[model samples]
Target: MALQDQPAYLIKMRAKPGLGDKLFALATEGMEKSGSSDRFIIAREDADPDVLWNMEVFRSHEAKDAYENSPLADELRDEIIELLAEPPMRIEVHPYSALPDGPA
Candidate 1:
């Protein structure tokens, strides 16, 4: 599949008070090692310090699915759940266009 055909997601999370930084660090590390994403950006909500957001672009739907179902993901999820204030929200999106370099 082409890079423009990649799968992407917007994930919103609310970390327990005082645990936002930890959550962000853990999630960032996971993404860096996941091998499923070509690029991912993680951010914190300015209005709500405990709120976190992640935009991930994966090579393919299959790659994303495989990573999500893998034991590594499970381990990370288990760790993440303990620091979350609530369940995360995930929105799937399609990439319609990108710069010459590609989607960031």
Candidate 2:
């Protein structure tokens, strides 16, 4: 399938003060262990040190749905919520395009 047509989400999280680093670590760990994602990127906001973002692309719609309903995902969500100052915000989309690797 075309990468541009894949299911994706941009998630925004607000970590409790002094917890951004810990949140980033957990997010990175989750990405490394993900089985259904085509790509995953976790980033921190420079201006807002306690804010984090995650861009995730799933391999397919089914993959995304299965992952969302899985026990592992539930566990991860519960863990992540503990560090958040408020509920996460999620924006769902299909990617128009992306570089396979970051810009030169």
Q: List the residue pairs that clash in candidate 1.
A: none
Per-residue lDDT tens digits for candidate 1, residues 1-104, read: 87668999999999999999999999999999899998888998999988989989998999999998999999999999999999999999866766666677
Evaluated at residue 102, the lDDT of candidate 2 is 68
Candidate 2 minimal-lDDT segment of 10 residues: 95-104
What 10-residue stretch in candidate 1 is worst by lDDT? Answer: 94-103
Q: To one decimal, what is the Cα RMSD in angstroms of model 2 from the true structure?
A: 1.9
**RMSD values, in order shown:** 2.5, 1.9
Taking all chains together, the TM-score of candidate 1 against the true structure is 0.88
Candidate 2 lDDT over residue span 22-63, tens digit each = 999988888777688998888888999889999999999999
TM-score of each: 0.88, 0.91
**Candidate 1 to native Cα RMSD, angstroms:** 2.5
Task: List residue ranges in candidate 2 displaced over 4 A.
Answer: 102-104
